[model samples]
Target: MFCSGCGQALAAGQPVCPQCGRPVAAPPPPAVPNLAFEVANYANRVRALSTVWFIYGGLSLALGIVGLAFANSFLNGGGFWMHGPWAHGNFPFGPGFGSAIIHFAWVMVVLRSGLALVAGWGLMERAPWGRVVAIVAAFLSILKIPLGTALAIWTLVTLLGYRNTSLYDQL
Candidate 1:
């Protein structure tokens, strides 16, 4: 090694340069910030978010299926409330209007359910596109209110929070 002070050639582990008597300063150790806690926190949040997504998707799917069945029953004249003399004549919106609305609602429910399911799957699998899909789904879910709104906000914060972007990239 060469001494920094006098540029003198020194043997290994020398304490000082013999020519100039300059003490050898060992290089400082590389700085390595500990990220174990942050990583674990983010990982837990991701798992929880994905779990919530799955539960929400399942519930939505069930609700959509039930809604479809009810709509089918109503349209087919099988619902007791939709029968009798006042069924068709007393209806305010007239025929087929309610059916159209129900159809639209069921379709929306199915779409939302599908989106939630896909987001959950992507997140659980740690797919490259998972973050994007989850963000999109979270934005869409923000209007759902109560549980959905809370989940959406949490998801947004976890995935897009400061310093989280790089951590997720490592995953």
Candidate 2:
């Protein structure tokens, strides 16, 4: 007989389920898969992928912060020797050119990190808007190649290709 608690096969006269330790009186309602089970399974997979987005967003934020710190230090320490002619103020844009580039990098980093965090949150909550944000983010992620491509594919499949439309609507 199958255990009611865990659905593991139970030998005759067994008092409790070995997998779940729950008492089993009869076979599970049926060995058949039901809609509830399928929905739960799909939701779990989506949540798992959402966790990946959170980690990616955090790393992006950290990397950006580090870049900002490095830029600030470099500017204050007068460590511009690597700029060649620009180091000697020979460039047409003057010495402020490096600062402008660093600022632009900081802006891009902030935008990327913010979007990632929002997308992660939305995916975890199964929000409809979050799905849209995640789709856009995934498309952008594809441009990153390799790892990003894999993540984007997984995210797209979990959110867009999921079989149950009702589950997301309820969430």
Candidate 3:
């Protein structure tokens, strides 16, 4: 029978849910195609995430470049070489230090972009590890400060609020 908690098919003669670890009412039926659907769903999420990552990565790279290049113009007291606490927060600073600082920022963006590329492709194929990748990537994105926070918040909403759009789990 189907598990009420996670919907994972229970194995025959099993007493507890394999997925949720909850007590089962009785022995379950054989596992079914929901596994297939789960994998496929995860893959689809990867593809969608890939597109988002690439887009944001590019934007992050560009913003970093601009911040660095025009550090003085955007300077509020901060400069390319120096950062005040609360970057997005109110502080004395320039846009950034300089081109070098921009380079560093873009480098981070590039890494995220690369991760997206890899996860997107693997997810499209429903690779067994795609879920892990997504989870890891989601965590990493949270560290990106403004960008990471935004991504993390949105992903959390998508994962928790909307059951129909479940990220990795499927029918």
Q: 48-122, model 1: which lDDT tens digit per residue?
A: 889999999999899789978877666645455776643643446677665777788888988999999999988
Which of 1 and 2 is the better model by TM-score? Answer: 2
| Winner by lDDT between candidate 3 and candidate 1 | 1
lDDT accuracy of residue 159 in candidate 3:
44
In candidate 2, clashing pairs total 0
lDDT of 3 by residue, 1-171 (tens): 777788889877788897789887754578776756766665565566656655665676576566655653443334455455634425445434443455665577577766655554544554656545645666777877887677666555444444534534451
> By how many angstroms RMSD does model 1 differ from the true structure?
7.1
**Best-fitting candidate, measured by lDDT?**
1
Output the TM-score of candidate 2.
0.70
Question: Candidate 3, which ten residues in sequence have the lowest lDDT sum?
Answer: 86-95
Q: By lDDT, highest first, what's the ranking?
A: 1, 2, 3
Supply the global lDDT for candidate 3: 0.59
Tens digits of per-residue lDDT, candidate 2, 1-171, equal 888877999999998999999997954476788778777887888788889989888888997899788775565344745465445434467677767777888889888888888999998988888888988989888776776688888887777744645666655
User: Which RMSD does model 3 reach against the true structure?
Assistant: 15.0
